[model samples]
Every structure is written in structure tokens, then in C-alpha cells.
Target: MKMSKAAVLQEYQKPLQICEFPLNEELQPGEALARVEMAGICGTDVHLWKGELPIPVPVILGHESAGRIAKLGAGLERDWTGQALQEGDRVVWASSIVCGECYYCRIKRTPTRCLKRKAYGISYCSNEAPHLRGGYAEWILLRAGTSIFKLPDNLPFESIVGAGCALNTALHGVERIGLEMGDTVVIQGAGPVGLAALAVAIESGAAKTVVVGGPAHRLQMALEFGADAVVSLEEFPTAAVRLEEVRRHTGEFGADVVLECVGHPSAVPEGFELCRDGGKYLVLGQYANAGNVEFNPHVITKKQLTVMGSWAFEPRHVLGAIQFLARPRWRELFAKQVTHRFSLDQASEALDTVRRLEAGKAVILP
Candidate 1:
């Protein structure tokens, strides 16, 4: 007879309605429940709110969260990494569950592209069974097929949720287009994904990194996360000027790798211009189709660029992110990116903070 409260998105471009649900004292086989500690507001959530992505309404909206295990089902005894799961163990779980029989899942063996995949916060309806399916709630029910991983005791909730899905999304993108030792990287957005990509690139042994994006705080965080140079959009104020600033840090030929983490199609042309002729251009930030852009296809041929796009992350990337963040310095750096916190009822405000790009990171302490 345990009741939990959650912030449900009743409609797009509308305030999230606070709702309550009852949790079963006994969990079904292969399921687990966690008491949500912190749920990070992701850029994707903001996109969903704007009706950019078609998500089921009356849905609870928080994909990146960490919590203490409350109850383990009959057969669910271990985390994704095979660690034993106890009631009090700290954990984070995958956002989506894929259908194993899909063409993308079975034939291609690429589950990330599974068209039938259902994400916790994005896909599930609030009225569905095990109603507390998102982290914007007091509790999140880790469904049967979801990969739940137990976090180490030393890792704080803020650090794991700080980067939110950005870390794993960046991880997948990096893996999709490999980063080399001593390569120069230019990250074209100072958002969470860009910052996480910067960290990942530096960790992967990039000789230099330049970040382009900003108000002021996000650029500062990029520096803290270890960027060699930062191009302030405010200072540059134009794509042409920012391109020049990026080239200054990267030298005459521009960076070896340029990451488009700006989530807008308009940034695509700049990404092309920011890469060295034969280098790579990675597009990972356009999760939702913002609009059309008029980038020249001739540049792809002229530059001989290895153009790549990473859609979303796989569960293994989550494990990779956890292992990467386990480092004390990394954990601390990411945790520092958390600039705003709100209660579950303030979910709309949290989304607004992210929408305006006001915080390095915003979270709901449900």
C-alpha cells in the first residue's frame, strides 16, 4: 500500500501535472523498484516538451536518474555488470527496452536502432501498469528487460546524474567514430553532451580540445572539464566569427575531429567548415529533427570528410559511462556541472531551466 508521487507530462507545451500511484509491495519476477534520489533533466526532455519528438503524453519524464534499490524481484538478483543487487544498493538503469526480435535487433545486431524500443520516460504512458516508470517520481520501477547497474558506494548521485544521458550518448558517438591518441578535437556545443564529449575526448588522449558554444557558465565548465580553448558564442556572436576563433585554436587546417552537439541542423554547415579536409565530422546532437538546413553536399566531396552520425546509446555504453565516471576526478568534475536542483513538483521549471540553457545541469531531487 505504498503510494508515490510523480510529475506527469499531460500535454506538450503545458505544465507537468503532479500525479500519484500505488506500488505493489511484491514485485513481479525480473523487476526491481528504486527510491529515486536525483533525476537529471535532459535536453531530450526539453525537446519532448516542445512537441519536437513524438512521445506518448501523460508520461513521466526523467530518463537519467540514480537511486537506492528498494525491492528486487524473484529472479532479479544482480546488476548489469553481474554485481549482486541488494535492497540498499545504489543503482542506475537503462532508459529503454528493445524488442529482441526486431530487424535492427536481430538481423543487424544493433539494438540501439530498434524501432520498437520503448524508453522509460519518453515512451511509457503514465497510466500504464507499474505506473511510476520515470525518475520524476518518488520511485521508478525497473521493468523486466531493462539493464539495471549497481553503482559503487563512493560515486555520488549528483555525479552520475550530472551528465545524465549525455555521457553515454557521447560515449556511443565516440565509439561510433573512433578517437585517436593525440588527435585535436573541436566540440561545437557547450551543452551537457558537448561537455561530456570534451571529457571523453580528453580521456581518450586527444592532444588538444577546443569548445565552441556558450553563454558564459557553460564555457567555463568546458574549461574546467579540460578544454584547451573555448569559443564564446556571445563574444563571437556569429557562426563566421566562431569558425575563425575555432581555427585559431586548431591552427591552419582546423581540428582533426569536429563534434556537432548543438542539436540544430543550422550547425551542420559550421561543423563541415570546422574539420580538417580529410578528418571526421560527427553529428550526435540532432536527436530530434529541428528543421532543414542548406549545407552544401559539395563540401563532403571536396573535404573528403568521414561524415558520421550516432543516433542514441546502447546499454553497454551505460556500463562504459559508469566505469569512466568511477574515476574520482571525473566524478567530481561532472558533479560540479550540476547548477540547479528542484523538487518533483517543480519539473516544469526544471525543464524551462534546461530549455533556456540557464544551467550547466538541472535535476529533480524527488
Candidate 2:
């Protein structure tokens, strides 16, 4: 057994413990070992820590990770040897493994929705040894069937880590929304995913892009990233008031597309109102346990509005996210989004910081 340092969650709504754990050295053919360099703390991680989402405890938590390929399993050595990968080559991995035989996979109807899906930091397959999974660790053992991509030589590790999970979600949401040139778009929430959606909307040629919701810094970042207008939700106590304010800034009608990046149930009804007649509403945020909201059915039927939902991204979205980050301007965006960085030992503190909305995005460097 090889020893590795990891931050393990011991209980719900509790601090994570930084402990030494035993890892299996025997890797299955096609597997690889990655020495983790950086892992971004996502809002979902905060949800899990707060017991808002049910992820198994005693688990090492981290999904947005980038690292270096340290060692390759037996048969993988030859294929990976000189192909942009080496003992210290930088890399980032797709977050989950899907069962290829599942019905969704067979029909090509969202493979990420496969019943046998296993997430790196959340769910573990039975065949995987405990230490072979998760990113909040000194070393992670990549199992077979995992999709690993080499990072561009010029890309900063923090940039890739910051863009990891959020960008993929943004890409998927934008694909679902199908934004067109000269379309008016409003993104709810100014967090990482919201800001990402805003960026993609602007890149998609949206004539006017508005970002609503805030903590000041995120709204500022949205403006920097090309948002035509930014609004702080704290000013409006009611959804109708917020919608009125949004309409005043936008045309008298409303936005052509509304993207909800705030997972709070309260935002769902407001998001629907932000979309104009014959517009689309995209829900990109992952809501916690059974939250309910009230919405007028007449608004959907009368306006001919399309309500869409997007979960984790597919492989194509992952590739698109990587390409989006390939642009030179992404360096500035990454630097702006990541406001806090903590060692793996301070995982709980980092998570708390995110929960309290203390930063735009917090990262954990192992």
C-alpha cells in the first residue's frame, strides 16, 4: 500500500479531516496515476457539505481537478508514452463514467443520464479501490473508462481548474438554449456558472446580455466579461419587482432567453418571468433536495415559452469547454474568478467560504 494525504468528509455538515490513507499500487490495465495539482471548489461541494445534497460520507470530495500524469498502468504505457503525456504531463479529467450499455447511451440521448453513472468525487464503482477515486488528494488513481485530456502547454493550471466543471455546464446549457445572433439574454445569478453562461451567451452573438443577482464582485466580473447590464437582487424584495427592473433595462417586452444559474427554488419562478413571449428559459443550476416553487401555467401556454433543464455535461460539452478556455482572454477571466485558494488540508474551510459566498470561486491546491 502506498500512502497518500487526503481530505475526507466524516459527517454531514461537519469539517473534513486531513488524514493519511492507504492506496493500492496495483493499477488495472489502461489505468493511470495522477498527482493532483489543483482542484476547484464548486457550489455543489458546498451543498454536499451542508447536507443540502446527499453524497456518501467519509468520501474525499473534489470534482473540478487538473493534475499531472505520474504513472501509467501496464498496457497503457506504450500508447501514452510519447503522445503528449509523460511522467509529469499536465491533464484534466471528465468528471464522470457512464455505462455504455445503458438505454440512454444506446439511443445517444444524453449519456450523462445513464443509470449506472459514477461521478469521480461523489459516486464510486465497486471495482474501484477507495483511494483510486476523488480529487482532494495528493495522488489519484484513474480507473479504466475515465476520459483524461492533456492540458495545453501554455494554459495555466489555475485557469483550467477554475474552468473545469462550470464551463462544461455553461456549454451544455447554451447548447440547450440555442442562443442566436442579436438575441437578448439575461443570466440569473453572478456565480461562476452564471458568469460562464453570460460569457458564452455574449460569444454566441447575443446583442444584449444582462446578469442579475450578486455579491458585487461577481456582478463586476459579469460586466467585465461583456454583460451589458448587471443588477443586484438585494435591491428588489419581490420577483415581480426584479422582473420589472430587468424589463426596464431590457426592452419593454423582456429577454429572448433567460438562464437560471441560481439553484435556489425562489429563482425558478422569477426566471420564467424574465423570458419574453416565445422565449426560452434554461435552468442550469443544480437544485438541492426536493425544493418546490410555484409558477403560472398560463405563462407557459400563453407565451409559448420553452422551459429547459440541463444537468452535467456530455463529452462534447467537455471538449467545447476546453476549447473556450483555449482563448487568450480566458487567462484574465480565470484570474478574476478565482479569488480564494486553500491547501487540501483546509478543505472544510474552503467549502465554508464558498457556502458563505465569500468568493467568486475557491480552489484547493493539493
Candidate 3:
């Protein structure tokens, strides 16, 4: 057994504990070991800690992770043996593991919905002992079937830590929405997910883009990222008014595409109203306990709007997001998006920082 320090979630609505735990020394076939260099605290982690989102307790909590391969297991070593994955080879991992035998996987429809799906920080497979999984730790044991990819040498660790989660989600949504060149887009919320969607929209050749959210700095960052206009929802009362304002800024009808990244139930109704006739609305946020938003069916019937929902991401999107991060212009985007960093020991504080919306994206470095 190898001893490692990890942040454990012993109870909901309580501070996470930094405790030492035992990890299996031997890696099974197809499994690999990594020494975590950095892990970003995501909004979902906050929901899990607040008890708003249901997750198995007494579990280690983290998914947005980046690290280096430390050791390779038996049979796998010969092919990947002596691969010289040094102390800092920089890498990121995909979050979910799907059961290939399930109905969804069999049909290749939605592999993410496989009956035996297990996420890194959310669900635990029987094979993984309680302490062996999760990313808020110094050492993490990657199970068999986990998709691991080498990080490009030129990319910064901070630029890709949360890319596996947030950026991948954005990429998935963008793909589903099928963004067209010269299309007008409106992004709701300036949080990590919203910001990511905005960046991808611009990179996809959006002719005009608008971002709606609160706090001056977040809006400022939206403008810096090529948003033609920004709306501070802190002063707005209803989605109708917000949509009206967005229409005035765009052509008086609405945007060709609307991305609801806020996850709040209210944003759903607002997003629907902001989408132009025949346009698409992509919901990328996760709203667990949020109350329902009332919308008229006539809106969709009359406008012929195409509404879609996107969750985490498939492996393909993860790969594309990593490649997107490797672009030369990525440095400028990172300069504004990554605003804070914390140590793994300060996991609770890091969660609080993201909860209060005090930073663009906060990462915990181990």
C-alpha cells in the first residue's frame, strides 16, 4: 500500500477533510498510476459539497485533474514500459467510464447514459475502493478503461486542468448546436462554462456575440473575449426584459444561437426567449434543485426553435478541447480566464472561492 494525502468529503454541507489514505501499490492490467500536479474545483463539486447534488459520501471529490504518469502496471509495462513519463509530463483524463454492454452503448446512441456509467469524482465502481478514486489528492490511481492522453509540451497545466470538464462540455454543446460561420450568438452567464462557450463561439466564426451575467469583471472578460455586447443581469428582474434588451442589441429579433450556461432554472426561460426563429438553444449547465421555469409551448411551435441539452462530454470532445487549448491564441484567452490558484490543502477555501464567484477559475495545485 502507498500512503497519499487526499481531500475527503466525509459529510455534506460540511468542510472537506484533508486526510492520509492508502492506495493500491500494484496496478492491474490496463491501469496506470499518476502523481497529480493540479486539479480544478468545479461548480459541480460545490453542489456535491452543499448537498444540493447527490453523490456517494465519505468519498474523495474532484474530476478536473491534470497530472503525469508515475508508474505502469505489469503486462502493460512492456509496451508502455520505461516510457520516461517524468515528474512533470503534463496530462489530463476523461471523466466518465461507460459500460460497452449497455443498451445505449450497444446502439452507440448515448454512451454517456450507459446503465453502468461511473464518473471519476461522482460515482464509484465496485472495483475502486472508496479511497482509491477521486482527484483531490497527491496520487491518483487510474482504473482500467480510463482514457488518458499526453499533454502537448507547449500547453500550460493551468490551461488544461478544467478543460477536461468545463471546456469539454462547451465543445460538446458547440458541436450539438452546429455553429455556422457568421452566425450571431448570445451566451448566458460568464462563469467558466459560459466563458468557454463564448470562446468557442468566437473561434467558430460568430459574426456577433453577447454575454449576459453579473459582476463587472466577468462582463469585462466577456468583452475582452470578443463579445460584441454584454448585459449585467444583476440589475435585471425578468428573462423577458433581458431578452428584449438582447434583441435591441442584436437585430430586434434575437440571436441565431443562444447558450444557457448559467444552469439556473430561470435562465432556461430567458434563453428560449433570446433565440431567434429557427435558431438553436443549447443548455450546458447542471441545475439540480432549481425550481421549474414555466414556458409557453406556442413559443417553440411558432418559432420552430431547436432546443437541446448537453451534459459532460464524449471522449472525442475531450480530445478536441485539448487541441483547441493548444492554439497560439489560447494564451490570450487563458490570461483572462484563469484568475486564481490554491493548494490542495485549501480545498474548502477553493470551493468557497468558486461558490462566491470571486474568481474566473480556481485550481488546486498538489
Candidate 4:
């Protein structure tokens, strides 16, 4: 058996241990092995390292990835949307595999909330079979029924890595809320998710978009990504000040929509304060259990605000994200968001850079 290199998380809050594992060179009935070109270190990955999200130990930690197909299994002929697939085609795969029979999948039609969903990098244990499950390794095994999308020749890997799961997640949330033309949007936290939400809001024909978040660099990128006005967390220094700035931009009516893209618990209550009467508040962050915050229910009733929470994305959202990135306006700017790249051996360093908010979008190039 051939061996592949992987960075294993043996314990929580510790650096990944580099090790070699036997590769399942031969594909099963519908499996495909992709040689990882670049894997992104998402904010969720940082949360996992901090033990914010519960998971099985001895796992290879990475989910946002892109690569070339090394091989394919029998009976697999086309991509997820019916495009032809072949060896050496550049591709990106959906992160999770959902059980189609679950209530959320069958009845609610929300496959992302399927009861028995198994995510590629997060759920797969390195101690199990087909050990090359995560993108932090040289190769990842695409199990049966995984939705894979072939990349066009002109599409750069940096664009996909720059957006990563953030774009897909934003696509899902925006679709849920239904962006209308000339809508005024206020987006909180200028991280990848926030910036991606800004991009979506602009494309959805938002008349004015106010971005709140920062360390200066991200807010600058938000402007470049088409935010009409920006409120810096560093400049404001408090939620009250930030809310005042947003109100100023919205002419004291608040905003048509306020999106909480920052995963911090404190951002939740403040997000409610930014929404106008009868406005919609979309919470795209708080995906992991980052603890809880106490907030009064009276705010919801008093403001007549619609509160909606979006979870992780589905495969169609990933496909839509690719199409959105393929646009000329987004391709170049999105690529620039990937400011840092490290080799697979430096996975620990990549996570640290993201945790410190020092890098735009950190990627691991194997």
C-alpha cells in the first residue's frame, strides 16, 4: 500500500502532528481521489482547534479545498450537474454527505440539516479506513455520491480558495432571505463570510451596503468588494458607536436588512439593534456552539423584525458560488483576498495566522 502525508489533530488546542498513512489507492464503486492543490483554513477550522466545535479526535482538519482528479471509480461519468468528468480535471467537492432519508432532507427539503450528515474533513476520523479524507493531506478520497464540480481552464485556484466555503455559505443565506433590488444592507464583521455577504448583496442589487467590522484591512477589502460605506470596529470601538454609524447611514430608519456575519455571541444583540422596524436580520455566523448570550425577546416583538438563522450550505449553493466567482467583476477581487499561503507542513501556522486575523484568507498548498 502507498502512504500519503497528513497533519493529524491528536488532541484539542495542540499543533497538528505530521504523520504518514496508507492510501486507499484503488477507488471503490463511486469514489474519486483528488490530489489537493490548495486547501483553505476557514474560521471554523480555527474554532475547531480552539475546541469550540465538538468533533472526534485523530482527525485531519480542513474542508475548503480544490484539486485535480487523480482517478475515478466505476459508473461515475459526469459531474454533479451532468458535466463530463475525466482524470486530471481540476475540481472542488462538496464538504458534506447527507443521508437522504432524514426528516430535514426528505420533508423540510433542507439537506444541510440532515440528521445523519458526515462532513469530509470534520467528521471523518483519521483512524478509520480511507484515511485520506481531509484536504490537509496530499490526497482526499471522494466517497460515493459526492457532488464534484470541474473547474474551467481559465479559473484560477486562488479565486476558489479566496472565497472557500464562505461564498457557498453566503449564497445559501442570501437565497434564504431573498435579496431585492435597491435594498439597503448592513453587514456585520468584515471577515470572509461578511465580505462574501457584501458581494452577494451588491450582486443582488442592493442600493447601499454598510459594512461593520475590522482591523482596517478587511474593511478596506469590503469597500473594494463594493460596500457603499464602512464602519470600522477599531474606529468605533463599541457596538453603540457602530450602531450609531449604521443608523446614520440608514437615516435613523435602521437598514432594510442587517446580516450578522461575525460568529461572536456579543454581535447577536447588537445586530438586532441595527435592523429597522419590519426589517430582516439574517444570522449567517454562529455555526458552531461558541456558547450563548442573553438577549431580551422584547426586541423582536417591539421592532417587528424577522430573525432568520442559516446553517451550512448545500451542494447547489456551492455550484452557484462557482458561477458567481466566474464573473469578471468578482474573479480578480476575490483572488486578492487570499493574502497568505503555507505548505501542508505549516498547517499549524496557517491556523494561527487566521486566528490572529493577520491574513486575508490563509491557504495550504500541498
The numbered model that scores best in TM-score is 4
lDDT for each residue of candidate 1 in 2-28, tens digit (9 for 90 to 100): 799999999889999999999776888
**Cα lDDT, all candidates:** 0.91, 0.81, 0.79, 0.91
Tens-place lDDT digits, model 3, residues 136-252: 888888877777767777887777874437788898889887999999999999888888898899999999999999777888888877789998887665777787788888888
**In model 3, which range of ten residues has the least summed lDDT?**
78-87
Clashes of 2: 0
Count residue pairs with overlapping backbones in model 3.
Answer: 0
Shift in Å, residue 222, candidate 3: 1.3
Worst 10 residues of 2 by lDDT: 77-86
lDDT by residue for model 2 (1-366), tens: 678998877787888888777777677888888999998888888777777866666778888888988887776653211344567878888888888898888787778789888788777522335554788888888877777777778878878777768889899889987999999999999898898898889889999988998888878888888899988877776777888889988888899999999878878788888889999999889645537778888888988999999888876676777678878887568656888999988888899899888888898889
Query: How good is model 2 by TM-score?
Result: 0.95
> Given candidate 4, what's the lDDT at residue 154?
77
Q: Where does model 4 exceed 4 Å of error?
A: none
Query: How does residue 342 of candidate 4 score in lDDT?
Result: 94
Tens digit per residue, CA lDDT, model 4, 316-357:
998998899889889888899999999989989988999999
Any runs in candidate 3 off by more than 4 Å, and if so which? 75-88, 125-130, 162-164, 287-289
2 or 3: which has the higher TM-score? Answer: 2
Q: Which of the two candidates, 2 or 3, achieves a greater lDDT against the reference?
A: 2
TM-score quality measure for candidate 3: 0.93
TM-score of each: 0.98, 0.95, 0.93, 0.99
